[model samples]
Every structure is written in structure tokens, then in C-alpha cells.
Target chain A: MSTLSERILGAPHGNYVDRKVDRAYVCDGTGMLTLETWKRMGAARLSDASRLHVFFDHIVPANNSTTATLQHELREFACNSSLTLSDIGGGICHQVMSEGIVLPGEVVVGADSHSCTSGAFGAFSTGVGATDMAAIWLTGETWFRVPDSIAIHLSGSLRGGAEAKDLALSYVNRLWMDGGTYCALEFIGEGVKTLQMDERLTLCNMAVETGAKTGMFYADDITVQYLAAKGQTVRPQVPETCTYIRNLELDLGDIVPVVAVPHRVDTIKPVQDLAGLPLDQVFVGTCTNGRYSDLVRFAKIVKGRKVAVRTIIVPASRQVLSEAVRTGILADLVDAGCTIGTPGCGPCLGAHMGVLGEGEVCLSTANRNFRNRMGVGGEIYLSSVATAAASSLTGEITEPEVA
Target chain B: MMQGIGHAVCLGQDIDTDLVIAGRYLRTKDHSQWVAHVFEDLDTSIAPRLKGAVIVAGKNFGCGSSREQAAIALREAGVVAVIAPTFARIFFRNAINIGLPAIECNITCTEGQKIRFNLADGWVEAEGKQYPIRPLSPRMQEILAAGGLVNYWKARS
Candidate 1:
């Protein structure tokens, strides 16, 4: 059994000096890397500089000068520093980190906040800023307040239309905006065992919504097999005994597809509740929903149907992209009027690609729906792969009405 | 109470730790590295005026990402305490846990009211008037006196 509370935070880790961490790493979403942002690598003060991984899951092809600079800097940094670069269009930060990099019971921090996504594998991960990243890049030491813990046990399996995304969203919503603030969410119970590693990744990816420092699901066989297939070693973990602040009861039932209407993520309502909400754009890729299986679902829907006018599909990775092409999913999407593009972190950052003009409404699979998050004054409605697909066909929010 | 060092006032939100100290010069562990860029965002007059002070700001002032540097920066820069309408929840906990004397003081004035705060008296003096900054309901005050959250954790351990 591993007793590792002090690993990510407590004492000075390994041979590094006692460098205190300020807060936690919640993970910033895609498009840039920080270690090279300040050029602090292999400084032993920062434990295992190579431990800080980089992947281009957000943007496959750097579209402009600034983004291109970021990409080039990463390549140069990884090569010069002898660090492992995970993705050349990897699916998403969480999945890539979980499939191999992190071991059970370890504490991980990323420059991205959703680094909490790695918690699904039983290691604690969160994000932070670049300066902090620079410090962590130099010395893996960080300061943590040791947040209160919340335990949620899942009992039921997800129905067809529900997917892990909806359940994850509902969990945060149930917790309310500040419900889980300053807490570590531990998703336990037999229901969690039913989820595929990919599905579990989706569940933990949104842990940030409730302001949680991290969300966790213990690592099991699925985790080992995934790593084994990639020729990586897997570690074991022991459960935490800390009492949870709140324990939610979740049983999988036939959940009708749901959509989070704009302005705030928790303002979500059923898709039928989204009637008459006209949209100008539809985006289908993000750290949350851009994955191989997610694309396959889109392909299933759009293959026989036309995408809503102006709808676009951004696969989470080039690997997902190549897989889509080889699997015929890409051809199906374009056949349905969907404009497919390179796997770059797009409008999700509210910076580039698929931006909605003022007053335009967009149906997106990204996490936040804050004003101007995707586009200034433009509205974003959050939904799952099935709902995004169904809404793409109608140019309005709609549910698949399927299991 | 604003007792130890009179309350401070740092105007505006998103006053990141970098504004407290630019990244280019923070390679040391001593608080001495702080004075250079204490208020890089606002007027440079801040450091000189902060012989002892507390900060006052608006809602979600510490919104966005978390950087402990902000706390260390403020603490080292000599901010005795912080008073805001509402905080980002994290910073509020952080400032208090680290022994930075942060309190929640409801302000009636719309904006820009300069006043005096007596930590010894537990009063907030502004707009030619005086208001109590305490009445923290006991448990809250104990946490504040213990010197912020992490210190409390260390003491407990």
C-alpha cells in the first residue's frame, strides 16, 4: 500500500530542496507549453524535468505565427531537454497522461487546470500558471493546502444517450458553482468500474466545473491493459480513508439527452428545453469531447445525414484524425456537409477557428459557456457527442432521443 | 482585527502574483525579492505607502488561475490583511491560511472611498467614519489568528 499524501505537496520531494507550492495545478486547456515558455528545464529543483510531458492535442497544425512559435519552441525544448513529447495530435491531455505517464497514487500537476483529468487513473493531477510551471519545471515542488475531500459513489451504468459526459456535468451541477470548491472529489462505487478508461476520462475531465482541485477514480485493469498495449509499466494504488464532505448517489437510468444552454455551464436543461434556440455554428471537438470514440459517434450520425449549416468537426487529435480517415469516419462527416479541419485547439480557447460573429449562437462540446468564451457576445450551448450531432443536423438544440 | 499591521488597500482585481514580482527576478527564497515589483500593475507609489496596509477589492478579484506567488508576494510586500466584498473563494482561504489577515467587509460606498483601518481596534475607518471589520463569529477569527490555512494544517500535523 502506498501512503503518498506528502508526495505531490507535503515535503521536499526526492533530492530537490524544500520548495513550497503555492496552490494546485488545475490545468490550463490546450495550445501552449510552459516549460519552454521560460526555458527552465532539467533543473533538479524541479523533480524529473522530463516528468512534465508535452503533447499537441489541442492544435495539430499551428495556424498562425504566435501558435507556430509555441509549437516550434516545444519541439526544440523537448529535443534539447530530453523530455518525452506525448502527442503529435494526441487525443486530449488527460487521456494521453493517463494511458501511460502517471502511475497510481502519484500526485501530478500540469500547467493546464484540467490536469485533474488524470485523477481518473488514481493519481492526483491539477493545473497552474506558466510561471508556476517554470518553477515546477525547475523543481517539481509545489505547495498545497491539502483540500477537503468529497466521495461520490456511482452505482448505475450510463444509458445510451447519456454517455459519461452528461453524468459528469450533472455531478458538477448538483454540487452547484461553489459546491465542491477547495475539495478533492473521489468518484468511487461499483458503477465507476463499469466505465471504459476513455469513458472514465470523460467523467473526471470536467472536475473543474465544481472548482474541485482534482477528481479521482481508482485505476484498475482497463488502465493496465491500455498501458500494456503501449509497452508501459503500470503501478498499483491503495484507497484513501479520508471522510468525504458530500457523497452523491448516482444510478444509471435511461437519461434523455441533455444540453447546457449558454452563459453558465450549470444553466443546462434538457434538449427539448432548448427548442427555438437558433445557432450559427456547431463545434464538436474539445478537451472534454474530442476523442476517437466521440468522432465515431459523430460519424455514425452524420454519415447518413447532413450537418446543420455551418457546422464543423474538430477531431481531438491527429491520431484520431488518421484513425477517422482510415475508419471512413472522416469521409462520412464531410459527406454530411460537415467541414472537417486539422486537429488544432480551435475556438474552444475562444481564440481561433469556428468563431461565431456577434449575436450568433453556437452548439459546442467544450466545457464552459461563459460569455465570450467561444466568441464575444456569442452564445454557446454545451452538450454530448449525441446531442451535438443531433443539434448539428437541425441547426438548433436537439437530443438524439436514443438510449 | 486589523491589529498587527494596519490594513492595506490594493485597488483593482486580477492583481496577479507576477504584478507582485516579475518572473524575471524571482530566483531567491527571501521576502527581499518582493519589493521591486510589488504593484507593477498599479502605481509604484504602492510599496512606499504600504508601511502597513490591507487590500480591498471587488468580487472574484482573484479569479482565473491559482498561483501561490500572489500570496507570498502580498505577504512579503507587506499587506497586513485583505477586505473585499467577496473573494474568489480560493484566495480568501489562501490569504487567511498563510497568515495574511483577510476579512470580508461589506462596503456601502459605490467605489473609491479611502479611510482608516485600526487592526488593534478591529475597525475600518473610511469616508470620515469608522466601521468594525470583525465580528468574525469566533471560529473564523481563530483561523485568521493561526496565520492562514496551511499554517493551521502544519500546526495540526
Candidate 2:
């Protein structure tokens, strides 16, 4: 009986002893530039270009001349190397990978911290930097120490307006932001079966905020269905016996809509506890909670209400944006006075579009409320898309009513 | 062999890459420009203090984001080494690949405290106290010795 990490690690390199991985991914943010620079600096040529995935979703549509030039260089590299490129507005790398590239039981690595979002499909996915990516690009292999495992057993189902974002916040609150550092969080229990695929992605996405190497779930029927819908077939694997350094049990029924206060991800409080806090802005997107389903949830809450505060909605991918447009989700949101931005990272990376002003408060669905995340001196409150939508109407922090 | 002795510039836990250097500064791949903005969010004065200093941070230092520029910024800013209980995997690997020495030790130290770090000896000394540090892997040691991953690979080629 091996842990999920061990199985994936072993599968890739024939055994977990070597921990050498084959697949590596990169995004437009720093990765493309770094790779190009490294190549000029005499790094070896890319080994098996097919294994490397590249995307230009961080600052899609080119926020400035520098970003535009960087994207142009990445485009040329992708074309020269014959690598698959998710061009500007195609979507985020994690979302693109989950939709097409990533498969169950594979060891997936990306050059973005949110690469853990692929763990929703049971892959051993984690983030790495440009230097490591450059090395992997040249050699088709990189090292891993085979992190220890932490078991988080969730029971029951979320009620009382609680969502996966709330569950993630509660876990971060319990685990502390850095409690899972160097450890892989293995999420299991009855509640696991109850979550939607997107919900599970949300849970795994924020695992990095807890400092976990990666967060993974058992690949079950839902995972297979998800992959099948994406035109891929996968036979999910479940580890029979696994060792957990620390085991924690959480009841989903016990969770309520919660928000992570500014300066740190773990500083959480119930949404009701912080209700009526004035909000200057509300953002409803990011790789963390920006999917079609997330947009649907946000639209449902903001359908007929005019936002009292400045609200920005960014779909995670071009596919999500198209779907929202087709389903009239975008229309509903737009009619509700929500400003829709391009399908890139938007203000989540603080790169461009909807940056916060000094001393302003923003209710956002994006992960990581660290200081200066949206902007310096701007306070960020992280919550579910539903909460963000509800708060946008009231111009304060408020939890949406459960249907 | 890599060795450095300098005063400690202490930082708290989860000192993320964004805090080290924001994404807004990453558009240009200029190392010098990035170094000037190191720790700009935490303390404007800390950037000047980083020169010839060893950063001593709590657990999970260099968490968040996979930008190698965080490590590059520190190295270019004249930071000799970074000592912390633990580091995010990406940052740890980047630091080593870029020839920046990162030591893992759970010893306590205050800002401005004199400390000595020796990679070959695998130990860090401060306040008349010494703590054993884990040595880097042979592959990593070779890379650092050659001044960076590109140099190591170039030398081998």
C-alpha cells in the first residue's frame, strides 16, 4: 500500500527511489522569459519538447510593452520548439492542463504555484521555479524528496451557505498557513464523494496557502467522468495503504461561510462576524474559484441586484468565458453592473486590470489575501464567489442566503 | 566550497515571493532592477540591510509563486545566504541552482546578530552557539560550486 504521492512518483520513474519526473509545464509569468534567458546563457536545448506545456494567460492581451514583448518571445519559442501553446486568453495554465493535458496517477509539475489545482484529478502535481523548469526542460527530469503525507478526513456535507472555499479557509485556519509545509495533504473521507469536481479543485488549489507541497484527492468515478467530459480517458488509482504523519477530521456540516482577513491566509473569521465591513471592490475570479460553475454561482446571486461597490468578474479561462456568454451568465452579471474583464489573471496577480487603491477593502474570491496582493495598503478579504457577489450588492461583507 | 559570515536580517514565517518582489516588477528580466525592489513591501530599509547579510527567516520562507526571480533578487542584492527552518520547494531549488546557499536550521537569532555559515562544514554559527545544517546534495553542491546551473551544465558540456 503506497500513498498517492508514492504511486504517482513510482509510476513515472519505475520506482519512488529516484523521484525523477518527466512532465513539466510553464506559464507566461516569468517562466517563458526565464527559459529564454537560460537558453541564451548556454543551458541545453529542450529535451522532448512535447512534454513541456506553455501558456500565456498571466497577463493576457498584453498589459504593457514589456509583457507584450515577453509574450511575443514565448510565442516564437513555442513555434520553434513545436510545443503546444495556450496563447493569450486561452486560459490559465492550470485550467488548461486540467482540461486537456493532466491525467490521473501522473506526476505533474508546473511553473506556477497554483499548479496544485491539477491535484483535483489525483495527479502528484506541485509548483517549481524557472531554474528548475529550465533544468527539466533540458533533461526531462527533476528531483523530488517524496514529501510526507497529512490526512484530512472530511465528513458530512456542507450546509448553511458553506462552500468549498469555506472548507478550504477552515482548513487553513486549523492547519495554520504554514502547518503543511513540506507535506502533501491527502484529503479523504465520506465528504470527498459529495464535492463537485470544481469544488475539489478549489480545495486543492488553496492547499498551497497552507504551505503544503500539494493537495490531492482519491481519483474516483467523478474524476473519470470529469476527464471523459474533457475528451480524455483515465483509470483512477486509489492507494490501499498509506501512512499519515498527522491525521485530522473535519465535518463539512460544521463549516460556515468564512473569510480570510488581510495580511495572511490563515486569519479567518466567519462572514457574519465581519458583516457590514465596507467594501470598495469585489472580485469574482482566479484559478482558485473561477470556473464555469463558480461564475454560475456568482451570477445567480447577482442576477437582479445592482452592485453598490465596484465589482469585477473575470472568468478563469477563455472556455469559461465562452460558456458564460452562451449561457447568458455574462449577460446577467453585466446587467447587474459587474464589470467583466478578460479571461486572464486580472488583479489577482496585481499585474493589471482592477488594481486596488491604497487603504481600500476588497472582497475577492481569489486565494491568498496576503498584504499587497491586490495592491499595497489595500485590504483583501477572501471568500466564496457567492459571498463576493452578495457583498457586492450590499457594499459590505455579507454571506449569501442558502437556497 | 561556499562560506559566508554576516549579520542576520530576520523575517517572519511565510515570507512569500510576492513580498520578496512583486509580480509587477517581473515584466523585465533585468536582475539588477529586480534586486533594487527586494523586500520593498516588508521594509524599504531591509533592501539596504540585505547586502552582505544572511537572511534568517522562520518556517516556510519563500512560499507562494514559482517566480525564480525571488531567489535571483536576493542573490543579486548581495545576500550571501538564507537560513530558515524550511523553504518552499521551488524557492529552495531555485536558490541552489542559482548558486545561492540556503541552510536549514531551527536556531534562533536576532537582527544584526553576527553569524557564520560554512557549506563544506554543514554548520551555522551565531551567538557563541553552533547548529548543524544539512548539506546540499552532491548534484546541488556541484551546481553551486560552478556558480549556477547554466555554468555547471556549460562546464560539463
Candidate 3:
């Protein structure tokens, strides 16, 4: 038997980046669709039995008619397919499926770009176009291109002021815009040595922003230990060796506070550069920097302060929600009059959940602020949670003043 | 890598794969049904009048996902080539990897700037400069000559 990597790279018949390669469909059982936008296709494709997950999540708080329609379709599809993960209302799509569904070494695809989040479980996860996803939904298979690989090694101690959000933004800046195209970004290093599981998840969540197919920080003892506590799957262990085409190195010690300005991710500069720039709003959420530490960081910054007239905080998961509540961070936030939101993706997707209206400028920790991405007549500047939090309080672009 | 002033239009940055062909219309069986709809959101007249069109854009012109459909839809819709101050990391590679002529140069084109791009001749004429962009690496030239990956592989067989 050929090794899995060999099968992945050698079989052009089954590998494609959209140029009609041959048929090579196999199931490792790491995916499913909860919405019927995919149901317009057949159900047997999901009967790959092991490959299907068909979950209904992240479409909640149905803020508008279109989201409501998609959610209704998802309920119908999940019911028709008899899938367990379907209709699991209260979690992010990535969190819901992997809670107990996705297994290791599985090659999975989803329509959502963040589908790569499954790599945390050691699966070969990537996102697909809705049409390709539809075809896979009918035939139970799709193809792929053997992408090049880039290794990002994070080594050193994260000083008191730095966090994963800072690290991710720093990494993106170093690579600039076209640094990691059609490549697999493999994150490795020593500073990663002490980061807990959710923090590591926060790092890999935005890997797609670099134009990489997926970002995978290898699962080590930390991975297994966290899973064991959750009672999730414990797969055999091995060191992840890299066949990276190139390597970029980083030390958390020197990563300065930064923000990606309007229009482009690579146009990043130190947050201090834009001092006194008026800020109309500040947002702290999205799959990227919306974890517990993110909230804790925001709370710490806003403890004795009040949000400038227009600032919002969006927690990404119910898990982060409960933990923030348990630690009393949510109360500190509300006491400061920061408009805290439910555990759904809001400001990030421009789903209108927390959009800033026309002529408004928001400093945010969310990713991808494309035209109208957050709402009409609004401009979004991408930044770390610390920057967003500090800006919310000062009512202008600022840094976390917390010592 | 196109030739002559087929005409140039300026589009703002963050021009995603969806702006080329929206995700919702992807389910259609006939590509013409949807490919023709490419960029309808940006400019309705673009598709019908693109038989000999060229585009010049600011940096990160196609900086989004590795969706080749974006290139395919553009090619099928008659966009000869693109010259950008810079391009998205993935979109740049995807274009070249799939044998589409996408060039990156440190230049800008104003609206209605007369331009002649010769991918075959290996240079461009824009804003009164005939600067050179290295032509397709030999392997890439072959892929583009073959008119896409499937045909290239078919010829190899």
C-alpha cells in the first residue's frame, strides 16, 4: 500500500485545482453538510457513511431572511440524512463537527473557508467552492492539488504583552500579501510550547488569510492531553516532519504590537503609527481572535474604562461564552458599556449581525474587511484584540494600556 | 500578457473570486449560464464587451482563495490577461499554475491609458514605457499553449 501522502501527491487522476482531473474519491469521514443549499444535490453522496457530517450551526440567531432560509434548508437536509451532528444549534461549525465527529488523518472539505480548522484534529482539512461541495455531496468525493508547503516556526517566550493574535498578525505581515500561495503552512516552534489548545486553535484559524490551503500546528503532547481531558479521540502519536519548500522563523519576544490598515492585510504598521486617528467603532470577535484569552485580554484593557460611543465585542463560541462568564470577564465588559454579543459570528462575515453603518470606521480583530463585509458605508481596519479593546476605551486607535 | 490596447478598466482592491463569479450561481450545469454573469455586480457591461479587454489593478488584485474558477471564468469571459501592481498570493500562483497569463509589475494604468501587452512577444506598452516582464517559464508556456491543464495532460498522454 502506498503511503497516504504518496496517494495524495501522485494521483493526478484524483487531484485537481479545478482543471478536471480523473476520478479518485475516497472517504476518511471528516465532513457533512447541515444545510440544504447543498441538499439540492443527492443524499447518497453523504452516505459515504464515514465522510459525511452535515451539520447545522453558525447559521443561528437568524438575523435576516436569507440566513433564516439557509437555516431552514439545513434543518430539512439534516433530518433527511439522519445525521447526528445536524441541528446542533449552539456552536461554531468547526467546533460542532469536531466535538466528536471528525477523526484523524481524514481528508475533509467544506464550503466554509474556515473548514481548515479541522486540521487541529490531525485531519487533512480544506475549504471548497459551494459548487464543488455540491458535486461531492452527490458523488461522495472531490479532488485536490498537491499544494506546496511553507513552515512557520514560532519559537521563544511570548512576553507579557504579546498573545497569539499579535503573533498571527505579525506572521501575516512578515509574509506580506503573496508570500504563501497554494501552500500548506505548517506552524512549529518553542513559544508554541506553552500555548494551550484554544490558543493554538486561535493561531491556525486564520491561516487561510495567508493564501495557504490550510495551517496546521502539529498535535503534540499538548494536543493529546487536552483531548484526554475532554475524553475525545486519542490517536497514535508521532512527530510531524516537514517537507516544507521554505521556512520562515519567528520569536515571540520581538513581535511588536501591530494593525493591518484599511484595504489590505499586508499594509500593516505599528498601532502607534495611527495615534490620534479618530475611531468610530472597535470590534473584538470572529474565529480568528475570539477565544477566552481574547475576552480576558479585552476585559483587562477595559476594566476601569468605558467603551467609546461605538464599540462591540463578539465571542465566537459558547465555550468561550461560558468561560468568560465563569471568570466574570463578561460583567466587566458590560459594566464598561461595551455592547457584548451572543456566541455567533457577527461583525466578521458582514451577515449584518453587528455591522457599522455608513462613514463609520471600526478597528477590529476580525479578518477580511472586504467592501461591505461589515456593512454599508463602513470601513474596517483589521487589528489584534488588544488594539481593538484599547481603541474601544480610548475612542481612538490605541494600545492596551494594561500592565 | 496580452497584446495592444484592447482597453483598460480599473477595479478597486479586494476584488474577490465571488465578484468574478458569485458563489450562489455556481450550481448551474452550463457554465455559460453563470460565466456570463461574472462581474455583473461590478459592471453589467463588462461581460458583453470583454472580447478584447485588459485589466490593470492596484496591489493584491486577486488576493483571496485558491479558486481557479475565478481564472476560468475570466478567461472564458474574454479577459486576455491582467497586469497588476501586485496580486494575491494564491491567485497569482493559481493563474500561472493553470497556464493563464497573469503578470505582476510595479506600474499603474489610469483609466483609458493606451496599452499593448504582448505575452507572446514578452513586453508591455503602457504609460509610455515598454518595460519587460519575463515571459512564461518554458514549462508554463507549454501549459498555456495547451489551453489549460486538462488539455496539457491529454497531450502528454
Candidate 4:
């Protein structure tokens, strides 16, 4: 009996194993460094150019000439090397990869920490540093110290305005930062089936916040349906009994909307505890909660109501953006006085597009709230799209009404 | 045994990678900018003091982001080593991959106190006390001694 990570890596807990990478990617911020390291290593011939991807999402449209030149160089490298490139506005790298590229039971590695987001699809995915990625580009393989697994058993279904983001916050609060370090969080139980693909992605996206190697759900019909919709088919993975370092059980029905307070993702509290707190801005997008379902939930909350504060809406990808446009969700958000930015990681990493100013506060749906992450001296509060939309309507941290 | 001595610089717990190098400076590959701006968020004065320094920090040091630039910045800034009770896994790997020693040990020392360490012996001496560290694997020690994974790989190839 083996956990998903052990099954994929063919190694037991705490053992080092080198496996061939099925997919490897890097964003612009890391891509330049990776390219430099590759050159430093004699520009060795790539092992598998087709499996490599370069995404420009962190700082899109060039924040300045230096960025523009670097992006231009990356574009040239991608083209010359025959690697896949997702240009500016293509959406976040993880979101784009999840659209159909990443399959179940494959080894996926990205330079960005959010790469673990793909583990939602049942792949053994994790993030590595840029130089490590450069080595992957050269050798097509990397080593991992197979982490022990922690089985998280979830039951019941979320209700009453609670969302996957809230559940994610709840789990992180329980685990605390670094509690799951060097461990794989295997989410399994009746509640796993209750979550749709978007929610599953949300859960896995925040795994890194716990300092975990990855968060994963075993592939089932929900996973099958999600891939099937994209014209791909996959078999459901049978659950096998495996030893876990720790076992945790969560009842989703008991969950309520919560927010991760400033400076730490694990500093969580129910939304009502911080209600009525004024906000300088509200952002609804990121790999964490920037999908079609998330936008729909956000639009449902703020529809036909004027926002009381500056709100930014960034779709996860071009596909998500066009779906919002085709379905009138974009119009509803725009009519509510929300500013639409390019479909990328907008102001999530304090890179560009609506970065918070000194002494400013923002309620965002993105993951991390680490100090100075969005901007120096600026505060970030993380929550669900529902909580973000509810807050935007009143210009304060507000909990959403039961849907 | 590869080892060195340097003045100690102390910091508290959970020092994240963003504080090591902000996203605003990531667009440029100029290593000097990274060295200059390292720890600017915490204190601009820390950068000037980093040269030949052994940073002794609390637990979970380098906790967020997988940016290798953080490790690069510290190495280029002439940091002799970083000693913490624990490290975020990715940062620990990045540090070793870049030839920056990330020692796992618990030690208390005042700022500017001279510190001595032995990587092979897995112990650090500060303020007339010796604290044993979790020894690195032979593979990791080889990479660090080779000045990083690139050089290690080059020698192998």
C-alpha cells in the first residue's frame, strides 16, 4: 500500500529517489535566472524541450524596459529551444497547466511555489528553485526526498456561504505554518467528492502555505469529469491503504467563512471577527481562487450592487476571461464598478497592477499574506471570493450572506 | 572539513524569502542589485553588515517563495552561513544548491560576536558555547564544497 506520492515516485517515506520529470515549467521571474544558470552550465542540450514550458505571468506587459528586455530574451529562448510559451495575459502558469496539460499520476515540477496547485489533479507535483529547474531542463530528471504522508479525512459538505478558500484557511490554521513541512497532505474522504475541480484546486493551491511538499486528492469521477470536459479521459485511482504520519479529520459542514490576517496565512479567524474593517482595495483573482467558478461566486455576491471601494478583477487565464465575457459575468462585475486587469497574476506578488500603497489594506482572494508580500508596509487579508465580494460592496471586511 | 569564522548577525523567526529579496527587484538578473537590496524590507542597514557575517536566526527561516535569488543574494553578499533551528525545505535546498551553507542548529549569540563552525563535525561554537547541528548528507556536503550543484554536475559530467 502506498500514498499517491510514493506511488508516483516509487519510493517510500524519507527515501531519496530520482525520477524523470513528466512536465517542468518556469515563469518569467524564474525563467531568466534558469536561462542564466543553463548558460553557466555550458548550455547543455535540453533533455526534452517539448515537456518544458515558460510562462510570463508574474510581471506581465513589462513593468519597465528591463523587464521587457528580459521577457523578450525569454521569448527568444523559448522559440529557439522549441519550448511552450504562455505569454503575457495567458493567465497564471498553474491555472493554464491545469486547463488540460497536466494529467493524473505524472511528475510535474514548476519553479513557482504554487506549482503544487496541480496536485489537485492527482499528479505528484511540487515546486523547486529556479536553478533546480535549470538542472531539470538539462537532465530531464530530479531527485526528491519522498516525504511522509498525512491523510486528511474530510466529511460533510460546505454550506451557508462557506467556500473552499475558507476550508483551506481552516486547514492551514490547524496545521500552522511549517507543521506539514516535508510532508505530503493527502486529502481523502466523502468531502473530497463534494468539491468540484475548482474547489479542489483551491485546496491544493494553499498546500505550500503549510510548508508542505504538496496537497493531493486521489483521482475519482470528479477528476475524470473535469478532464473529460477538456476532451481528455483518465482513470480513477483506487485508494490503497497506506501508513500516515498523522491522520486528521475535518467536517466541512462545520466550516464558516474565515480570513487569514495580515503577515501570516495561518493567523486565521472567522470573517465576523474582523467584519467592518475598512479596506483600501479588494482583489479577486490568483491561482488560489481565480477560476470560472470563483468569478461566478464573486459575481453572485456583488451583482446589481455598486461597490463602495476600488475592486480589481483578474481572471486566471484567457479561457477563464473569455468564459466570463461569454457568460455576462464580466459585464456584471464591470457594471458594479470593478476594474478589470490583464488575465495574469495581478498585484498578487506586488509585481504590477494595483499594488497596495504604504499603510494601505486590501482584502484579496489570493493565497499568502506574508509581511511585505504585496507591498512594503501594506497589509493583505486573504479570503474567499465570496468574502472579497461582500467586503467590496461595503468597503469593509464583511461576511457574505448565506447563498 | 570546510569551515569558517565570521561575526554573528541575529534575526527572529520565520524570515521569509520576500524579505530576503522583494519581487520588485526580480525583473533584473543583476546579482548586485539583489545583494544591495537584500533584507531591505527588514532593515537597509543589514545589507552593509552582511559581508563576512554568519546569520543566526530563529526557526523556520526562509519560509516563503521558491526564489533562488534569495540564496544567490546571501551568497553574493558574502554571508558565511545561515544558522537556524529549521529551514523551509525549498530554501534549504536552494541554499545548498547555490553553495550557501544553511546550517540547522540552535544557538544564541549577541550581534558582532565571533562565531566558528565545522561543517564536517556538525557543530557551531558561539559565545564560548558549542551547539551540535544536524549534519548534512555526504552528497550535500560534496555540492557545497564544489561551490554549488552546477560545479558539482560539471565535475561529474
lDDT by candidate, in order shown? 0.63, 0.85, 0.62, 0.91
For all candidates listed, what's the TM-score of chain B alone? Answer: 0.68, 0.95, 0.79, 0.97
Question: Sorted by lDDT, highest first, which candidate order results?
Answer: 4, 2, 1, 3
Q: What does candidate 4's lDDT look like per residue over A1-403, in tens digits?
A: 8999999999888888889999999998899999998877775779999999999888888888999999999999999999999998899999999999999999999998889999999999999998788889989998898999988899999999999999999999999888788899999998898999999999999998888999999999999999999989899998899999999899999999999998989999899999999999999999998899999988988889999999999999999999999999999999999999898999999988998899999999999887888888899999998999999999999999886
Report the candidate with higher TM-score, 2 versus 4: 4
lDDT of 1 by residue, A166-213 (tens): 887788677754566656778877787788877777777787666677
Over A1-403, each residue of candidate 3 has an lDDT whose tens digit, in order, gives 2222223344422134332212211111112221222343333345343455554334346555654555555555555655434443345656554444555556667656666666665555666644455445455554466666677877887765566777777887777655765566767667777777666666666677776667765567777777776677566335445466789999888877777776566677777888767888888876677777788988988887888857787776677788888989999999999887766565565544566778888888876655545665577788878778778877888866646
Write model 4 residue lDDT over B79-144, tens digit each, in one string.
999999989889998999988899999888699999999898878999888999998877789888
Tell me the chain A TM-score of model 2: 0.96
Query: Model 4 segments beyond 4 Å from truth?
Result: none
For residue B42, model 3's alpha carbon misses the true position, in angstroms, by 6.5
DockQ of 2: 0.69
How would you class the docking of model 1? incorrect
Give the chain A TM-score for each candidate: 0.86, 0.96, 0.85, 0.99
Q: Tell me the tens digit of each residue's lDDT in model 2 across B1-157.
A: 2888988998888899999998778888667989989999888989989888899999889988878889989988988899999887778888988889988888897889998988887889999999999778777777788877777767754
lDDT score at residue A205, model 2, on the 0-100 scale: 95
Off by over 4 Å in 3: A1-45, A54-59, A84-89, A97-104, A235-237, A240-242, B1-14, B18-62, B65-157
Name the TM-score of chain A in model 3.
0.85
* Model 4 Cα RMSD, 1 decimal: 1.2
lDDT of 2 by residue, A227-319 (tens): 899899888676676678899899999999999998788999999999999999999888888899999998898898799999999888999
DockQ of candidates 1 onward, in order?
A: 0.10, 0.69, 0.15, 0.74
